[model samples]
Target: MASMKFACIVIMCFAVVGAPIAQAISCGQVGNNLKPCLRYIMSFWGSVPGLCCDGVKTVMAHVQNTADKRATCNCLKSMVAKIGFVPWRAKSIPRECGVVLPYEISTSINCDKLEL
Candidate 1:
């Protein structure tokens, strides 16, 4: 009985600790995180903003799984299509911000096919 109780407590601890890690990544969250990069994306040539790099790093840190990655990719692709950012500028964002993305940022990227 004592062992069973200990196991249950352990399971509960894991559930509580892992709750935030399992939280879903939504498009709204992605958009809000990346919003600071809009000025850099729209510019023809300029230094990447501190806030934009911070946002990029934040987004990258939050993306902890394949699902989160795919969702982020899809959200970015849709944003790029709608906002009409310069292709090269958009592609340079991760490197400029010192964040190494798993895949290239582009409208043509196959988000559904991304792997962890």
Candidate 2:
């Protein structure tokens, strides 16, 4: 009986804690998708790489709706925040890659501000 009760408690704890993880966009995923573009995004004097454009398209393709777009923007903002990237450089990533996104990838973007 005690073991069963413990199992139930553990399940409840996991359910509560894991819910957000399931819904939230992860930084690691974003990083992986854009990893190939890192050099171009960081550098001021280089052409956008072909792989970088592919990565941008793949990442943008996943953003199918307003919520996904917001989450992706937030995830990207977090990534740029950690790396101390130029906001304009980040904003120009999609454009430079010839990919259009619903929201601009600027530092000032408010994830929840606009709806698709």
Over 30-102, each residue of candidate 1 has an lDDT whose tens digit, in order, gives 8888898898888797878888888888888878888889988998889888986877887898898888999
Q: How accurate is candidate 2 locally (lDDT)?
A: 0.76
Off by over 4 Å in 1: 1-21
Writing each residue's lDDT as its tens digit, candidate 2 over 1-116 gives 99999999999999888865334445577778789877776777677778878878877777767887788888877777667565667778778878887777766778887576
Off by over 4 Å in 2: 1-26
Error of 2 at 80 (Å): 0.7
Q: Candidate 2, after superposition: displacement of residue 89 in Å?
A: 2.5
Whose lDDT is greatest here? 1
- Could you tell me which residue pairs clash in candidate 1? none
